[model samples]
Structures are given as structure tokens and as C-alpha cells.
Target: MVATADLYDERGEELASLPLQLRDLGGVAEFSGPVRTIRCFEDNALVKAVCATPGAGAVLVVDGGGSLRSALMGDLIAASAVENGWAGAIIHGAIRDSIAIGGLGLGVKALGTNPRKSAKAGAGVVDEPVEIGGVVFRPGATVWADRDGVLVER
Candidate 1:
């Protein structure tokens, strides 16, 4: 994958740079694919369900409302994502099992870590446009991420 910095330079005006300083928590340092979004707060039922389905190299973009109180994803769910062929995930909230997730092949970027798991009330919308850091991650738009930052191809 191309570095985010180079993509920005080559097509700065055509991309929307995600403004979050997310950390790379998974084994892969970079990943990119068409967007698949979920909007939730302190809940990950939808996240888990979506990851269980075939990803076909799409990136799951979770708008978790920036909640650090609980984790939206953990090792098990991440493993499911990898098995289902997801390219990566960008979580706008917390995740658990960082060390274990780091050993998996999927790329995971998130705000931070927490040991507490989120509620499973299925309180979220899937495949909808999710906005984070003033950028809208619409389904079908390509997203690229690396150590530098995230960029949405427009």
C-alpha cells in the first residue's frame, strides 16, 4: 500500500484526511479498502456481527463516538475480521486485547485501549455513513491508512 503521506502529496485536494491521531494496534501497519461503516456508542454487537460476514477486503470503519469507557472490539472479534478477509479496521473509540490483536494479520487503528468490554445490546447502525473527526466515511469510498494518518479517496 502507498504511504498516506505520499497519497496526500499526490492527491491532497482529492482526499479527506482523517484528523484523528489513531495508533496502530494490529500486526499489519497499513491497509486500505472500500468503506464499511458502523455507528455506535459503547456497544459492539453490530461490530461483531459485521465482522463475522465476508469482508472481501473491505475496511470496517467504526464510529464509536470516541468512547474510552469501554472497548468496541477485542481479539476474538478481530480474528473473525481476519478470517472473513477484511483489509483492516479504523475504530474511532477504544479496543481491548491490544497485544493479542497485534499478533493477528488485520490492521487495526484506534483511539486507545481498555480492558472493559462494551455492551451487546445491538445498539448501532451498520453500513451507514459514519462521521468521525469531521470526515464522513461513506460506504463504497476507499480509505487508506498507515503510521502517518488516514485518507479517504474521493
Candidate 2:
């Protein structure tokens, strides 16, 4: 559970910092794990499906195309993540029910909050490399996030 600042100081050249000013919305302040990615836009069916599976302490990295018009996840999916043992979630988009999600025992970082939920078209790619904020979040890459920011390492 090293602080983001310390991690950066120790591995400044090796880690890639997520440049977006993501908000810390979950109860847990620090979380890190191997990356699991989803690439979609305004659809959350895959997000729900992934959260239902066993996380094995991995972090779900959702590439929502940086859209703030709709939410890709909410309280229910986040609760599922906790129940299934996901270490955390880093969403490159919006999320709803921020207040409720903040109470859950999961680490969630997102671009911002929105009240409108996303569609359930079930259209998206999973376990793929998703680039957000100039970082390519590939499957199996390790990600760490704290109040300072997120950092990724291959």
C-alpha cells in the first residue's frame, strides 16, 4: 500500500502516470492490481458482466471514451465488484450514484459523476488494450491509484 507519491519517487521513470484528474469516489483510498480492461462507450452491460465474475484481486479498467453524458457504472455494479473481490475500478468516464458508491468497500476512480445511467446494449470489447489519458491500459499490466493519482507499469 505505498502512496502514489512514494511509488512515483521510487519508480518515476518506469511508471506511467494517468494524466486525467480523476476523482476518488470509493471508500478505499488506495488500490493496486493487475489490469483488466473493457472498451466501450455509453454501454455498461459488459461492465456488469465483468464485475459478476471473480476478480482475483485484479483491477477493472474501463475505457468509456471519456464520455460524461452517461454513466458506465453505478452502485450496484460496484457492490458486485466488492462481492466478487475486485481490488478496484478505474473508469475513464462517468459514473452514477456517487454517494452510494462512496459508501461501498471498493476503490473506484472515475473522471466524474453523472446521474444518467448508460445503455445495456452489451456491445463492447473485453480484455483488450484501452488507451485513456495517454496511457494504454493493457491486460495484465499493473495499476496503482491513490489520492495523488494513478500509475501504470508494464
Model 1 scores a TM of: 0.98
Give lDDT tens digits, candidate 1, residues 1-154. 8898998999987999998899999999989999999999999999999999999999999999999999999999999999999999999999999999999999999999999989999998998888899999999999998999899966
TM per candidate: 0.98, 0.97
C-alpha lDDT values of all predictions: 0.95, 0.94
Candidate 1 displacement at residue 148 in angstroms? 0.2
Name the runs in model 2 displaced over 4 angstroms: none
Q: How well is each residue in 1-154 modelled by candidate 2, as lDDT tens digits?
A: 9998999999998999989999999989899999999999999999999999999999999999999999999999999999999999999999999999999989999999999989999999999999998888899999999999999994
Candidate number of the best TM-score:
1
Worst 10 residues of 1 by lDDT: 145-154
Clash counts for all predictions: 0, 0
